[model samples]
Every structure is written in structure tokens, then in C-alpha cells.
Target: MLKEFQSLRLVETDFGNDVKTNPEVVANIYSSLLAKFDHNSDGVISLEEYMTETKKMMKDIANDIGFMPIQMVLEKDSLLMKAVELHHSASAAHTIDC
Candidate 1:
């Protein structure tokens, strides 16, 4: 993910893309993403947090993968769907706001 975050130039990944990779921006994103999975609010994500979040995400994606197209067409909403929308919106907004 960090590699992909570093590679963000022409396109936005989970993190925003920009013309430049400033240290502050990198740090902000690194910290924000780290905070997301760091359930204990620690500076680092524990192995348990990492594995649990990974498994949850895998289950979420696996369950929804088949219905994604239909969901998009139907505009169905859920916490995961809303979070993804907010993530993309915030990625763009954060770049501009920062």
C-alpha cells in the first residue's frame, strides 16, 4: 500500500495522487491509514488488528464481489459502500484542503 501510495501520480490510489510527494502529505496519509486499522489508537497496528481487519475486508469484498455490478446499478448503500465513497471524496478533498 505504501508502494502504491508512493506511485500515486497520475491516479489516486487509497491515498490521494498529486503532482508532488511532499513529506507532510506522505506523513499525513501514512498516519491516517495507519490509524484506520490501528484499533487501539496506537502508533502502529498490532498483528491482531491487522489480521482481523484483513479478514473482515476479505469477507466484505468476497461477499460483495458478485453483487458489485448490480449494487452499482441499483445504487444500493451500506456502511462499506459509504465508507468507500467517503474515502474517495476525502482523498480528493484532503488534497485540496491541505
Candidate 2:
């Protein structure tokens, strides 16, 4: 699953196109990724570990990019888009006054 995730990440992030030719680079990246998720030193990441790490990473990102208008290329049916829709609905249902 880690290998699959790394392969997908490389493809998704437009890196390591030639995994066979550049095994060193791929291995280096994979090792770094493994080091990140193996936080408990158990050499494998469980679902709880993944979620905890992901949430921390997201929180760190939000803190670093605080109050900045974020523009992401999102699909219409994506979770983020759904969050936006929900926010808009709630806004429409309420009236804010100064």
C-alpha cells in the first residue's frame, strides 16, 4: 500500500515518470515518505496514524497560509466543493448585521 501510494503520488505530482530508469530518486522519495508516516517507529502506518498525521499536516498548512484566499482546482462533486456548498447554504440561511 505504501508503494502504491508513493507511485500514485509521483504520478499525481508529475514526478518520477521513469521509475525504472530513476530507481534511486524513487527510492529516496519513498524512504522519506515512509519516514514521515512511521511516526511510532513500528515501521508501518495504521489508519489511525495516517489520519492523525494528515490532520496535523493540514493544520500546519492552514496555519502557515493563514487568512489567505485559497483557490484550488476542484471537481464539482468533490468533498471540498461540498464544503463550499454547505458554507454558502448556511450563509444564505443567516443574516449578519454590524
Off by over 4 Å in 2: 11-21, 67-98
Among the numbered candidates, top TM-score falls to: 2
| Backbone clash count, each prediction separately | 0, 0
Reference-based TM-score of each model: 0.45, 0.53
Tens-place lDDT digits, model 1, residues 1-98: 45544454433454643445576777677667767788988556678998888767855664555556654432456655654565568668989998
The list of candidate 1 runs beyond 4 A from truth reads 1-19, 68-98
What is the per-residue lDDT of model 2 for residues 40-63, given as tens digits with 9 covering 90 to 100? 878788888887777667545534
